[model samples]
Target: MDTILDALQEGRLFELLDNDKTDALQFLAHIIEAFPEVPAGTDVVGHVMKREEAMNTALGKGWACPHARVPFDEDLKCVIGWSPEGIDYGAPDGKPVVLVVMYLVPENQRNHYLREISFLARALENYPGLDKLRKVEDLDDIRNYLLDLIDVSKEPSGPDTRARMIRLQARTAPETLVFQDLSNLIVEPVTLVAGQNTEPVVLTQNHALFEWLDSVKDLIGRIETEGVYQNGGWRVVRRGAVNYQGSRIVYDCVAFKLIQNRPEKYK
Candidate 1:
């Protein structure tokens, strides 16, 4: 089975300028023409739309994965499109779609197709990664970003695993704050919360706040708060280090919690 990176690299990535879902699919079909494995009479758009008729493929956070299993004997193929202005993809979150990843797989590759889709859904759930994807203008950069994510995903899961987070303070600051996992990508404006009068503000999962605490930083101990209603909302707390200008800054970061008002699932 071809990995996600293999499918991505073997496929095409381009911008879909000001087009709806149907038009976007058509454009992808045209792009797929360059692939020699796809039969000359294959109806790429038709296959995708037929799948959509059964169910919309929009997986929220401004992403959609529309796929179809073709009657071919080739490996899985992908076509990734980015729409900076967003498109109406019928997402459950009511958010316009910014990224569309289309897949054309062989009929016998059902397991591989499902695994790829599931992995993408989990990866897209990371707000920080989604935020970075929105600002990606270069196609190569987008490819590299996805590749880096695959590497990060391979890192062993443990108590010390660190999820990516954005340092809200540097959003508007002149100096650029960079994280190793994520490069110099600017934090999306939506991730920042307007503070009342303090430099320290309560961070949320939407803000990409909590993850594993860095032990190399200052000697402050980590604290885990159980189901607290403080910080203007109900959230679990875990202290972690955020990399800022030449130092590791520690903060009482808020972690994700199961709440009644949680955002709807992206189907």
Candidate 2:
């Protein structure tokens, strides 16, 4: 779903053009023309126009990502276009628009389309060194720059790393669980050693909690007898939230549970 990198790698996404918006539209038409299953020529233009009637996808960074969720059999496709001279498209900033990245996605593919839009939104949000975008006159340069930027963006963003732990499904409600940066959670650093038993296992889902415990099963199994942690495949403690009176204390901390569950509501 990462932009420019995914688009260029897909091969059919790139489109070189002169300094004009009409060319941009025509180029997009050509790209859709190649996909005969979705009709052709002016039909593609009609799709774009219909979507545009709802709202301008242009957020005004001298760029716009016009998109439509068209009915199709396969995944999504992107058609990239550039105009060096820039054209008046009534951008929010009242600036002339120079580049257009059109996204055509299948209606049924909600996740892929949303993910692609998210990636595109992030890329455009940074608007980092967009003067480079102004200079790109052909498809090759655009492809190279886009690929390079996407590569740079992959180097472990802190929030992104935390978010990676939970494999969120598209149909899953967004108000149940969320990723919160531990760095932001505390006023100062709170370092805990690996041996710290008091450290709470904070997770919103059953799988995540189980996964963490499963990863450190050896440590848990040998804690009482050996008083040491070792890598071994052993049966670890499984608290089913049923036992009231037991040799060891095992109770769900409502604070930690609430902490893990609250963030998704805000999102």
TM-score of each: 0.54, 0.50
Estimate, for each residue in 1-267, the C-alpha lDDT of model 1 and write its tens digit. Answer: 134444443335566653467767655554454355677657776788799889999999888888867886787777777787788888999988887888887887777788767766776665356667667766545655666565455523321122121112223335422211122111111111222232333333343322222111211321212211122222232222334553434343322222233333310
Evaluated against the true structure, the overall lDDT of model 1 is 0.53
* lDDT by residue (tens digit), candidate 2, 118-205: 7656866674666787687665566545654554455333233322322232124343222222211111111112334544332323
- Candidate 1 least-lDDT 10 residues: 183-192
The positional error of residue 197 in candidate 2, measured at the CA in angstroms, is 92
Candidate 1 local lDDT, residue 166: 18
